[model samples]
Target: MRRFKGFVRGVDGLTRDRGGNFAVLFGAVASVLALGVGFAVNISQLYNARSSLQSVVDAAVTSTARDLTLGVIKEADAKASVQAFLDANSAAGILQANQIVLDKLTINRTAKTVQADVHADIGLYFPLFSVGDMQRVTTSTTALYSDKKIEVAMMLDITGSMAPNWRSKTDKIGDLKAAASQTVEDLLKQNRDPGDPRIRVAIVPYAEAVNTGGLADTVFVEAEGGPKVPPPIDTPLSVSVTTATDKCATERKDKDGYADYSSDGPYTLRQDNKGKTYQAKVNRDYRMKVCPTAALVPLTADMSRLLTAIDHFQAAGVTAGGIAVQWGYYMLSPSWRSAIADACLGAGPTNFDQKKVAKIAILMTDGQFNTAFARSRGASRSQDQGQVSRSNAEAICENMKRDGIEVFTIGFDLNDPSMTTTERDQAKSVLKDCSTDDSSSLKHYYEAANGAELSDAFGAITRNIENLTINR
Candidate 1:
């Protein structure tokens, strides 16, 4: 009986012993903690991989959509384009190019969208405890694109400085023609139907004044009477209204004032009490110092006529940028549609519709605006013409932009060593303010140092216009 009791006590002692129990519990807990840490690390890695994949996919889809919209690639080539983009940049963060794959690509022609799905197999850091060896991160992106009908009015500066002179050996006019022609061709040749072009362009070559061609009678109020006018009587019963013999037109002095931005008008005619019955504002007999003969061409898709007009461009007169900008706005303004129709220039600009149509104005200049007329012959006061031109251009641009017109301005060689500090800043300021404020703030304004840069700027503008947008 004593032996049995001793054995029972020994068993109870063994059961109550705390030795090694702590070590076993700690081992279990350590294993679980290690697993938790590994899982957290892998999750972070997977998140980074997903973000990179999403970025690449978005870029790929946007690029492909732009190509598709530009007709540079077809739907069948879309997958390849997306694949190429992925291959180039798939190994962005915590992922390798070999681990990434383009799973699917969809081109919705009817909806004008391109969508892409991409996936990456991220290696797992925590593969124990029945967890998989890899985790999948997937992302999809969609881009919307279109080639809406576009109307572009180009205000080209053909000032005397543009010609080959002792000051400049380079032919700036030649460069301008090439760059401008390429823009027209690129924008117009995209039309699948020539009979109904999606693009129409107008050329406003301004020197001292805008040559209105046959549009003078329709747009400007001509002053009556000249050296051959009859004496002024009480009624002036037998007065002769001198017809406009010169096609050159300058700023209006109508009831709307000098800086009026509207194109709709039966402008008030100028009057004179003397036997010289006609006032000087619209007097055809008065000639400008340097008038451009390359008359303003209204919006048209006729490449031949446009090219011919560009070919005949002559560098003469001082820069009349404000008047040129006014004419540019008029070409695109709907109020002047009837006048254009009356002149038999094809159906004028379409009404402003942000989605279905786009209106653009590209103004180019090589020097500061130095000329403006306050009366029939010249300025009434001695004022800085550059400031006047800049202010007027800004006002006109403000009105044009309010109407949804996108303005782009180019200052070619404005930074040349020849220009004074004040002159350069003033010239650049006008161009910059006149341009549309883009998201990047650089796309709509260009400062070209040379002809090559000019061409590149134009190309960039064209691409920006055709660029696709990613859906939110």
Candidate 2:
């Protein structure tokens, strides 16, 4: 019996030792599993934080890219914008701790690209054997700014037909004004250059006839005594011939037969019944002196005058897109080359960067070409018509293109069935053919069927200009 008890004691001792060994093994396994779980949690948190930081960087880079292209924001501003984005999107605690670092921010002006690199150090929950730094995360992004300077002219239709809501819409003039003003603002905002005039814009409003705004003076003299005088004043002259004569007393016409005599010969003087001896002013000399030059003045930041002109736009007469386009070309022509050089050479090319400046025309119309002021009876009429003919438009576009002038065209809400398909086709063909070779330049053409769409089209063009980047 004693021997049996001793064996049982030995077996109990073995069982206790085995139980202790199992306990140690179980504890070690549990510790490893716990460590694994902690690592997984910390790694996931690090990934989440890294992703969040990368998103911030991406947003920042994109914002900077847009500003870079627009030319409005300088490099400093772009960097600031990126920083602001990061600060705005970062977690409050992380940002305060300065755990996020913008390692690199580069803007390649020549390449028209922006690049950003970011790094962050994240804290890990598992301190087990602390591996170097708790966590390190990095991200980068690149964006391209591939737009170019835009030289554009806005040719707007202001014919009497526009007086009626031809498209069965609301006030046509109001809509036009809004669209035009917005477009102008957009262009100015997008293509701003403090040091150079990268883009030149002009507004040409036309009807059966365009009011040259008293261009007769400029034209008649420039005509070099050609039969065609500057186009007749669109509206009557504000100052009548009598008023003009009254302004000059030396040569006023006289009612009395004996005009005021002078050594220069009986001065062409006149006496009124009121006994006011009015002299027929030989104001012709003075008129000649003040006669307006046959030149179109390029506009600068003359926003007030431009806006006023747009507001006063009256829909009178008929549509003459051909003449308008011709005028647009003439406005930028070197016809006054000598004068431009003389007046602006001293000032360095009249607000334009003569070195890299480009000329452009934006011709838009909703109607077919039907009239020209210079039409003659026989071949001249045909010739004048031909100048505005679709073929002629194409030729003009080609010529302008050859001269390195970019051209953009737009056709708005044209739904006239009476208008032959050929006419519409002609307009489209000319517009498409007139586009510039540059991708950004060529993207300016648009066709819209409604007011909203028209506005959007204009906005899109503006955005394109804003995104322009100088390659060099």
What's model 2's TM-score? Answer: 0.61
Give lDDT for model 1.
0.76
Per-model TM-score, in order, reads 0.72, 0.61
lDDT tens digits by residue: candidate 1, 1-472 = 9999999999988867955797799999999999889988888888888888898888889888877665567778989998988889877877786667888888886687888877888888778566688777888899986656778999999988788655566888988999988988887776656777777899999988888886776433334332322222244534533345567877754322334555543222234344333322332224355558899899999988899999999888798788888889988888777677878988888887766678889999998887765322233445677767777788789989999888999999888787899888988989999999867434799989889999998888776655412221
- True-structure lDDT of candidate 2: 0.55
Backbone clashes, candidate 1: 1
Candidate 1: pairs in clash: 280-376
Which candidate gets the maximum lDDT versus the true structure? Answer: 1
lDDT of 1 at 111: 80
**Residue lDDT tens for model 2, 150-188:** 455566777655565646655656667788888776666
Q: RMSDs, each prediction?
A: 8.0, 14.7
Highest TM-score among the candidates is held by which one?
1
